[model samples]
Target: MTTFITNFLEVFYVLIGLIMLFAGIESFRDQENPARIGTGLFWVILAVIFAGAKFLPYLVIGILILILGLLSLFKQIKPGNIKGIDEKVAEKSAQRLGGWIFMPSVVLAILSIVIAQFTPLGGQIGIGISSVVALITAAVMTHANANTTYHDSERMVRSMGTAGILPQLLAMLGAVFTASGVGELTAKAISGVFPVGNHLLGVALYCIAMAVFTMIMGNGFAAFAVITAGIGIPFVVAQGGAPVVVAALGMTSGYCGTLMTPMAANFNSLPVALMEMKDNLGVIKQQAPVATVLLVIQIGLMYVLAF
Candidate 1:
């Protein structure tokens, strides 16, 4: 029962992919849809990635990615909503729920943390189980119907359109970077340029590298795995540095990059388009100062504590 509880989150993900695939097909079949082909291609790529990834060979997955990459590069994706929620109804629900609307999320965080700290389920599995429970709590609290969860989730996917899967795709690219010896190559190159014996410079370099790489990658998460493997564990963690502090602070440094990069379209650009704002770079501009300050703070913390 504990094991089943831990591993069942995959079922939720599979359901999400099915929703995208079906919605894509629905759009493709509709004559009134403005972005039929683009929408279909976009969601099909997302759906196949999530649903078929478990069974598909790595080569086939790579080919699928190449195709999707070419399609995106050539401006072949667009949006057309096939279904969605009534905003007024949703607003009404939120208003009625009041403070309780936050209960599910609060419960999820506490449960995940507690289970991870005390149980053999492990942190990742604990979070997964907690997520499933949280969804149930949300469903019951909102008095949602059998199909409400599925339909509501699908509506969100349809609304986000092409940007929905940007984070996932970028994460895959990070994996490919790791597999292609980029991390090893980068480590060698950097080591040749800088003396790793100087602990202060080495720590600075590692944290800054994480931020710079994250900025380029558009995701702190994607950059974390690569940068940590390349420069983090080797120069900092192994050299009498606190591994946990260095890692946590290094990822925090990477988030500074997320704040300033346009490449993080989902974070920086999507809000502008969604809100119909005049300044395209407004979000990044606003976040830049805060990110820089926080990054400095992280660097200081790492220097003081990690060593």
Candidate 2:
């Protein structure tokens, strides 16, 4: 019975993903409602990728999905024209919703929290209940405003979709890589080159390394996986510095790296694409000075504080 229930839940998850994908695709076709179309496509892509991860290797699929999502976020792509029928329906929907669609999320959140506190099911059950409540609230809100012509919900979904939970997913991936002992091995290799007894210098070097790695990787997250394993948990901890402080400072220093790399596409490429800049490196060029200054400050601060 337990196995059957678990399998059912898994199947349900896949089904939900498929439904989202299909709805998104359908929404994308409404010519008069470009926003809804974009939103629907985004949801569909998300759902398809998530569902695909169940049967396929998650890491490969995840990387592909991430790349595709990021590419979609590039501002250079022109939106397709919306038709009259789609536009009229979307406008009507928006009018009925009064332009404020997020109201239901707030109500659902409150209800979820309330249920979480009083329910006997504890954390997992409470979370599940809360998600259901939130979904229902959104559905009810959408239905109530069904007669309204506003396509704002679809628009909202599109605008939020690219930024949606991507960072969290990346962070989780980095965590998994870090936990595989790659971080420690990398840290040890680097530490071998430095002499012992120079605790402050070592910490400073680690910070600098983190900054450089972050810049090269275009993501502090990826750098964190490597640096934390190589330097943060091992050297910083072994050197009598607080692990929390080192980890925190290390991450801050990584942001300095974000300023210098084109690989930080979200921070650099997205803006450049949006502005239609002639120079692809325009964002990085502008940010370089500020990033350098910040990096120095972070490295110095961490060294002093850690040592």
lDDT of 1 at 287: 98
Model 2 TM-score relative to the real fold? 0.53
The residue-by-residue lDDT of candidate 2 on 1-307, one tens digit each, is: 4565455456546654755564465466755554654455557666776566567777776676666566467632223342234667557867888746776677667766776588644444445556666766776766735422234344433344555546756677667767786766776677688764467776777788888898887878767766777777666767787777788989888888888888889999999899999999999999999988887887778777776
Report, for every candidate in turn, its global Cα lDDT versus the true structure: 0.80, 0.67
Across 1-307, the per-residue lDDT of candidate 1 in tens digits comes to 6666534555655756787887677657656666577767777777887776667898897888788778678776665555667899889998999999999999899999999899866777677778779989999999988777766665666677666677677677667777898877877888898887677887888888888998998888878878887898668886889999987899889999999999999899999999999999999999999998988888888989988
Measured against the true structure, the TM-scores of the candidates, in listed sequence, are 0.77, 0.53
Q: Where's the lowest-lDDT run of ten residues in candidate 1? A: 4-13
Q: Which ten residues in a row have the lowest lDDT in candidate 2?
A: 75-84
Count backbone overlaps in model 1: 0
For each of the candidates, the C-alpha root-mean-square deviation to the true structure, in angstroms, is: 3.9, 7.6
For lDDT, the strongest prediction is 1
